[model samples]
Target: MSWVHIARKDFADAGRSMMLWALTGLLILAVAGISVIPYLLASDGTTPGFEDGVGFLFSPIGLLIPIIGLVVGYQAIVSERESGSIRFLLGLPNTRRDVVLGKVIGRTGVVAIPTVIGFLVGAAVIVALYEGFAVVDYLGLLAFSLLMGLVYVAIAVGISASVSSRAKALAATLGFFVLFDFLWEFVAMAIYWTVEGSLPGFDGLPAWYLFIVRLSPGQSLSAISLTLIDFVGAEDIDLTAAGRVAGEVPFYLENWFAWVIVTLWIVVPLGIGYVRFKNAVLS
Candidate 1:
């Protein structure tokens, strides 16, 4: 069978299940937290209408998409391993590369649909309510949302392919997702606090320190997403002087550099995991 057929079947299995329901719950919570509450509690008698609400609603998509990706992709290979079916697949003439690529594509489709739908619905609501909507900006935001999904799905698939136990796979995915999303911010904040003096006074910190912080997939992605949202008037994040200085790097240079970093976050661990899975002992 073609890998496309396998990918399609996997996509269907991942989609028509409780994962969709969980994603819906997350959408409700995020929409409510950022949009509904803020709208209802506005001190001014006139609430920001649906357009403003939708803008607010999308602010958390960056945080939520990765979690959705983890939930959707974490069992792709690990569960097969646990049930002794991975060997059966390997027994086929197919290459391990096909299996890995197919599973990643399938899982990506599963998460991508809800992400696109939620984003469209929110954008449509905003257009209906707002007098002048920047349609192009919304499209760019949707694209960024998908990138956010891709990043975590890649990470989760790597974890799945490398692990043996389904439970451990799930725990590792959730734990790492939470750590990267929440704890990483705490660590970054600690760094900022520790070097507040040097950060302001010194010529510059070592490239090593910047590289370590830049490796935070969540931090960089979230910052970029927030900047995009701010440009669209969706969110109001204050850009520090440091951020402004960083942005002054040549556009082409900064763009390619950022892409390289994002690609590394998605590719390096996945390549490592793929190598491990290819060499895994299947007895």
Candidate 2:
């Protein structure tokens, strides 16, 4: 109950900030504006289908949503600590667990609101320009994007709670983004090269190799996305482990298992953060 009040207050405070509106506007551009690209790029006399728009949208969304989540959540708790308001917050009935939980819920709302709005506006654009508009598929992508937002926010918030300083939190979160989003593929490739004596290609990839690649939050979400949104030409190119692996797809590599991985990403960090924050001596 205290966490609920804390969550409400946190969201209300954020509601008053121009930062919230700014994020909403940015997402509007990212979802609605970026979704228009397929139509614009379509060849003459060819009207792009809804799947085409969703497929084109996946790339930018995969990149953008995580960054946004990190940015919004990184400072959620550390800022209060830095400003010495955490002592005031703690002076209230709220426990350390409540604070962390509240921050997660509040910051999640901060990301989700704009994301939902952006998707709403994007739906209009897709309906107008695209030939076949599948409402279920559209909702699927939106749900996945929201889930992605939650995963990153949980991570960033966890970092914020564990760190005493905002700078340290920022550094850790940025390092996470750079490592996972930018260099994880290279890391996986290097492991594959070192072990297999050659780089992994489209098919014939080992199960362990695919598992290593899927460890990143983005990749896990991407795997889940294959199930969520039916991209144009998805039949021709199989992104799933079943398509890439030589033998049977391992249970861990199954499409449904990606959700388990993503859930772990959310839970492990928050659990660790809560434990650290719980034991910290508040001066």
Candidate 3:
């Protein structure tokens, strides 16, 4: 109940800031604006279908949403500590766990609200410009995007709670983005090379290799997205781990298990942060 109050107050404070509206504009641009690219780039006479828009949107949404989540949540708690307001926050019968949980909920709202608005705007544009508008599939993408947002927000907020300074939180969160988004593929490739004495090729990858690659938040969510979105010709291109593995796909590599991985990303970070914050000396 106290966490609920904290979440509400946190969200209300953010609602009054330009940051919230700025994020709304950015998401609108990311979703609606970027969605128009496929249509404009179409060389043939055929109008891009809803699937085309969704497919084209996947990469940018995957990239942008995580950064947005990190930016919004990285300062959620550390700012209070840096400004000496955390003492005030904790003085009001709020436990560190409540603060962390509430910050996750509040910052998640900051990301989700704009994301939902962006999808709504993008939906109108897609329906107007595309040939086949699949409402269900589009909604599925939105849901996946929101889940992705929640994951990154949890990560950034966890860092925020674990650290005492906003600078440290920012550095840690940015490092995470760079490592996961840019270098993760190379890390996976290196592992593959070390283990099998060869770089991983398109086909016949071992289950462990694929599992390592998918361990990153983006890859896990991307796997889950394959289930949510039925892209045109997706049958021909098997993006799932089943297509790459030589023998049988392990249970861990299944699409359903990606949800478990994503859930772990949220819970593990928050748990670690809570434990650290619990012991943090906040005089």
What residue pairs clash in candidate 1, if any at all? Answer: none
Worst 10-residue lDDT window for candidate 1 reads 238-247
What is the TM-score of candidate 2?
0.96
Q: TM-scores across all candidates?
A: 0.79, 0.96, 0.96
Candidate 3 lands at a TM-score of 0.96
User: Candidate 1 lDDT (Cα, whole model)?
Assistant: 0.68
Residue 46's lDDT in candidate 2: 95
Error of 1 at 173 (Å): 1.9
- Model 2 lDDT per residue over 115-227, tens place: 99999999999999999889989899999999999999999999998999999998999999999989998999999999989989988989999999999998899999989
lDDT of candidate model 2 versus the reference? 0.91
Candidate 1 Cα misplacement greater than 4 A, ranges: 28-38, 41-51, 185-208, 226-256
Q: In model 3, where do residues sit more than 4 Å from their true spots?
A: 43-45
* Candidates sorted by lDDT, best first: 3, 2, 1
Model 1 earns a TM-score of 0.79
